[model samples]
Target: MKVLVTGGSGFIASWIRKELLARGHSMLVFDHQDRRQQLADGEEFFLGDVRDATAVTEAAAHCDGIIHLAAVLGTQETISNPRPSAETNILGSLNVFEAAAQYNLPTVYAGVGNHAFRLIGTGCYTITKSAAEDLARMYNLYRDGGRITIVRPVNAYGPGQSVAAPYGTSKVRKIAPSFACRALAGAPIEVYGDGTQISDCVYVADVATAFVNALEYTAVHGPTERPVEVGPIESVTVNDIARLVAEQAAILTGREPVAITHLPMRPGEIPNAVVTSDTSTLKQIGLDAIDFVPLDEGIRRTVDYYAQTWLPGYLAA
Candidate 1:
């Protein structure tokens, strides 16, 4: 089967591409070569932008299906430069759906929790993603052959991530990075608001597997997997993620954590939102969270990855 993956050069998209290829599926990538070419090698991608209808159509022309993971990422990042965010995340998705609708193809639409559900104070990223998901669903309503599945992941974390987005750099690094960076700073972790706000987090590999599984399921059956939310064994709190990170860091360095506190909650944040899709439905469709990675192990792996690859030399030292 030939598969088209938009934003194929980014963290999640790259992993999704590899997973697709590993399954022996021919792959084409629909992402702008906007300095992201560094992440791709020769003979790997089709080289196009999702915003360009002509490019997107050509890329999707011969593909069996598409795993739509291309989008502007990170909360603060989207809010900072909403122009590109809107163009790529929202309009780009529109182009994909339009192209798929014309070709009458099957697609798995990837979105985040905040983006799909309208959490308070959500940024343009979520807004666009939410719109895109709806557009995909609407396309399903009109086209008999177009199958659309929506999967909303909450702040996916782990190796191969590039975390310097506005969200991370602006000192609002979601739950995971906020904790890991604090631990690296030898400062106690801090939770915004009461720390009771909850969200899902999944390892990148697990999420990648989920994407492929979703694509396969849609291929086998019709895309009825609306509201697809895959997470770890449990839903966790902000404090839970923080404590876990601090605990893991202590074991890694043999030092006690300093201070863990709570600050003001970011405006429009979801007070409590933990979306866990019914594995039974996924199972029925030949998909399962059978490879769910434990949070502790995932966190340890993520911390090490950031420490080694992303963090500056000074930060590591």
Candidate 2:
């Protein structure tokens, strides 16, 4: 099968690309970043913005399936400029699905989840991504062109996670990236609030495997009727993640952790954010939960990766 991964250069999307190659499928990575001109060795790269109907149509034209992963769903990125976030996360996703429908490409919506609990907190980012999911489902029902499934993974992190700095309160903290960067820098291992807040984090490799699994199911079963595949990744607490980071850093750098301290939990921090993909629909599509990697091991590997690849520069910063 031919699969197109939008945002294919991103940490998670790249993992999906890797999984596809391992499965012996042809892959076209559809990315808009100027710096991502080169595919990661195996993928056939296509340059396109999900915001462009034409570009999305052109990219969708060439693939048997698509894992739509591109979106600016970060809180700061979204609330900082709601227009672009809405356009990209919502409108951009619409184009991808419409194009998929037009060309009848098998489509899987991978990697979109809410940090904020929609029923409780201010939820611009959640609202937008949720809308995108809804649109894809509707397309599946009415258009009758292709397959549609959504993998709403919560707190996806592992090796190759983002290290970009934050923009606002809405952005919150870069939990995994910031923790790894701080630990490597020998800076205090910071925890916001009591650090008791629990959340689920799916390992990128496991998520990539989930995508591969979903792709296989979709191909065999055809587009899910009332189509959707929901996967709730493994969950952990912020404090536990920090402790694991400190532990791993001590092992990696051959020194004790500099500090483990707390900052006030910022306003709008969800007390506990737990998300599950709609479970009833999973059996309908012939899907089940993928084997989840344990969180401590996942963080250990993530810390080791950032340490080797980005630590020297990150510490310099």
Candidate 3:
């Protein structure tokens, strides 16, 4: 099968591309940026924005399947600039969906469970993403453009994960990378609002595998609009995440254990957020809940990746 992955330069999208290629699928990466990973003989890239209908349609012509992963994410970024977030996350996504409709291409959409649990606190990101989800459903219903399966993932993080850091911005709102970097530098692991807020930190590789499974399921079976929740069976509190990252970084860097500090809760902080998934539903799509990477081990692996690959260049820059 030939696949077109929008936002292919992104961390999770990169992993999806790798997973697809490993399954012997030819790939065409469509993104505004250049490919971060080198393309193999069967892979190619088309540089363009997802908002451009012409560009998206032309790109969609080159593949049999589509994985829509392009979005402007991050609470602070969305809060600071809602217009761009809406334009990209909502309008850009519409372009992709419309192209999928035009081409009658089977598509797998990446969704967020946070959008459904608005009690956790909603922001511009949530609003736009939620709207995008609605558009996906509309396309699935009206267009009859092949199959579209929506998979909502929770707090995806691991090696090669890219936090929401725009070029001219200094704020890093993501928790995992922030904690990992601070720990490696022997800085205190800072938590907000007494560190009680909970998160379902799913491993990136596992999420990638889920995407592959989703693609395959749709390809073999047919279009199904039922949303599939992809996340861990367990949840970890903010304080536990901080402590675990600190401990793992200390071991990897040969540094003293870092202290966990508390700060005022940010505006969009969720008091407690948990993700629940139907394991039987996941199994139908070829995913098993028992395969999720444990939090402690995920943190260790992430710390190692940062220590050996990302941190050195990050600090020097």
Q: Give the lowest summed-lDDT range of ten residues in model 2.
A: 164-173
How displaced is residue 128 in candidate 1, in Å?
A: 2.1
Q: In model 1, which residue pairs have backbone atoms overlapping below 3 Å?
A: 115-126, 120-268, 121-268, 188-259
Ranked candidates (lDDT, high to low): 3, 2, 1
TM-score, one value per model:
0.85, 0.87, 0.92
Q: What is the TM-score of candidate 2?
A: 0.87
On the 0 to 100 scale, the lDDT of residue 161 in model 2 is 71
The candidate, 1 or 3, that scores higher on TM-score is 3
Residue 193 miss distance in model 2 (angstroms) = 3.0
Best-performing candidate as measured by TM-score: 3
lDDT of 1 by residue, 1-317 (tens): 78888877767887777777687776777667654454433225667878888988888887878888877765656677678878988889888887877777778889775554564567777788888877877778886566888776656887766543332543335566657766765777777778777766887777788788788887888686456776655677877788888877776657896578888766445556544444454554455666678888899997776556544654644
Each prediction's whole-model lDDT (CA): 0.72, 0.72, 0.79
Model 3, 104-130: lDDT tens digits are 888898888677655446678877888
* Span of 10 residues, lowest total lDDT, candidate 1: 163-172
Give Cα distance to truth, residue 167, candidate 2, Å.
14
Error of 1 at 248 (Å): 1.4
